[model samples]
Target: MTTREIVQKLWNLCNVLRDDGITYHQYVTELTYILFLKMMKERKQEAAIPEKYCWDRLRALHGEEMYRHYRELLTHLGTEAEDELIRQIYHNASTNIGEPKNLEKIIRSIDDLDWYSAREEGLGNLYEGLLEKNASEKKSGAGQYFTPRPLINVMVKLIDPQPGERCNDPAAGTFGFMIAADQYLREKTDDYFEVPKLKPFQINQAFTGCELVQETHRLALMNARLHGIEGKIYLGDTLSSLGTQMGGMDVILTNPPFGTKRGGERPTRNDLTFVTTNKQLNFLQHIYRALKKDGKARAAVVLPDNVLFQEGDGRRVREDLMDKCNLHTILRLPTGIFYAQGVKTNVLFFNRGTNDTGNTEEVWFYDLRTNMPSFGKRNALTEEHFGDFIRAYTAEDRTQVKDPRWSRFTREEIRAKGDTLDLGLIADESLSAYENLPDPIESAEEAIGKLERAAGLLSEVVEELKAAEGGNRK
Candidate 1:
């Protein structure tokens, strides 16, 4: 079977989990626990797992005994495994499969897949496909952890990470950005065979990231391993003392989790100059600060709209970012692309300056969000969607790029706007004029559709409020 087919078959087995009250996100995590054992066995690397709790041993037992032993296996590996990576994967792990038969069905289905084809296509690709599938399901809520692959690819291409340079993602989210950078360098270096001396550095030290969620960290580790990356993936909060130590990186790329910190608490990292509960603002500060001050160290970050226009600390963060780095490009991303469909986002591209004074001369803004098709499951965001922006970004003389979607502003002009980076968006004629209107009936139907969507959003807000009120009572 092809990798795509195998991913589909594996994802379909989640139906078996439904009766056990396992969510799609939980199902993927559970699959990772089982798949790791099988994959290790397939690759003849079972020494990391204990012989008694290995894949063959678990597969041989029937129903109840299998389930019982599986539970023990998780505990044993988590607490007693000789391999640190293995222990990390199993630490605090437990089965969500309440029924033994369902567990057996999942195991059987996984074992029946074509291992040869999976290996040929690369196990990492297969696993990534599964992650993508999970992210596409809006109800799964895995989208927050998963940046769109096309967006990741575009950012990686623009950043153009090189071998022997240290790269990081503080909010890794399955380590997609780092993995893409690894692949990009591997392709350019013939999987590092052409540059044999740098292979060790590229594999072991070139890519690093930190993930806050334990389960997500496990998946990140698994993803890194399947791709032959031995780089460090830390399991801790980056906003704490841990992030304070992560500095002097050559390149940084990330899409930090949106919204304010829980309980309105500021980041505990004392090194950051700005104090705010806005997670993205703090992450933005961390990213630029983490880069090397060699003028060559660069970063690309995904942030929400509020970061662009929020007052007080937001303005200070923007000013600080511009001062320390050449805040060159901002790509305002289209809506409905992320799992949180209502949140509009943007990509800020800049490089750390050797001297942290008056480094930014001008800023280029790419208006990709305006006049764009609504991107979602049916209308997907692809590499082609980035064609114009990419050309403009890489152009020798960006001024010659005559597209209306592409524009630039001087540092003085940005200052005039009170340091708000939320600039650029050509006048959208569709919203401004009714000269090209459809029939009245069509217009009425469109207005009704928008109202329905608004009502649905309000309903979600009400449910959230109710849940919060109940929690207060408790």
Candidate 2:
């Protein structure tokens, strides 16, 4: 079958697997395992996987025996696989298929599809299609890790990643940013067929990432490998020592996880002078530090509204970001574009300064969120939503331009406002005097989300004050 048809068939089987009470996340995790094994077998790398528990063996079984083997196979690989790729993919893996028929059905379905090289775009795209499907389901909580492709494409176009340049994503969930960058260069250079072919090393080492969750990490590894990228994507908490481990990236495109840090623990790194349990704050510190000081390194990151306007640590991080980098642009993303609904997000595009501070002169803001459509599956967000933004982005000398949706803020103005990067023109009509109003339920949910964030930040402040008071007593 064609790659699309194969992907469709495999995805259609998710309905059957759902009957086994498997969650979408669990279904994708299990499918990743089987898919990896099958690809290896197709490439004649059977020795990499043990003989008894190989895909061939799984394919030739049925009923209780097959189900037992599937479960045992996951354990064996996790415990005994010599290859780290094989081990990591199966680490903590378990078969969520409660029914043997479901297991057999998925295995047979995958087996029937044509297994192409991991480098082939067809197979890689098919896998990505499945990932996107899983993300859209939303119930599995897989959506947060998956940024909309339209956004990713726009960011990649603006950043304009090139071959032979190092790209990384610190909080890479399924490595969507890197995947898009890889594809961009491929299409730009016609897979290196139009231009002189990229050196083999550039083809392999050009992109790297770090994913915290094991299942997502495995999927990212497979995704990159399938796209012909053979680079390391570490599986661990990125805010710890891992944050300090790498630096000097050419371009970084990532949507860091959205949430307050858990358990009120400080990051494990000594590199960041300012520390807090706010995960996004630490990530912001790390991302700028990861850039080179020569002004060549640039990044585009997706962050929440609190990161822009929260007090204390938020102010400190924003100040540091402005001082150390040119915080050039902010694209205020619309609500509901993400599978995680009601999230108000913005993309910060900046580059490292040649020195320690004062690189930023003016910052442009594009308001795409306010008075916009509430995006959902039926009214899915598309590239056209970014047309004006992209045009404004590509315009020469935006400092001279004046538009409602597009505006510029001088660093002086921003510093006067306590270093908050949130700038915009459109008023929230939904919250104003207007005849037509939004769904009361939607407004309530947005309010609740804001309250929860404020609560989290307040708790952090309380803890900090408590620690300071205790230190004084000591």
Indicate which candidate wins on lDDT. 1
Tell me the whole-model lDDT of each prediction, alpha carbons only. Answer: 0.90, 0.83
Candidate 2 accuracy as TM-score: 0.86
What's the C-alpha lDDT at position 178 in model 1? Answer: 97
Off by over 4 Å in 1: 431-474
Candidate 2 has an lDDT of 0.83
What lDDT is reached at residue 434 by model 2? 58
Global Cα lDDT for candidate 1: 0.90
TM-scores for candidates 1 onward, in order:
0.91, 0.86
**What digit string (tens of lDDT, one per residue) describes model 2 on residues 1-474?**
465666677778888876778877888888898888787776566888888988888888888998888889999998899988778778888877788888888888778665653325466787898899888764566887899999999999999987878999998899889989988988888786765656564567778889888888989988887777777789997788886666888899999987777788888898896898888888999999999898979999999999999899989999899899999999999888785567789999999988988889989899998878778776789999899899888889786556678988899998898888878747765644452344455466556756766897999999999999999999
- Clashes by residue pair, model 2: 118-226
Cα RMSD (angstroms) for every candidate in the order listed = 4.5, 6.6
What tens-digit string does per-residue lDDT give for candidate 1 at 257-372? Answer: 99999899989999999979999999999999999999999999999999999999999999998899999999999887887545789999999999888889999999998767
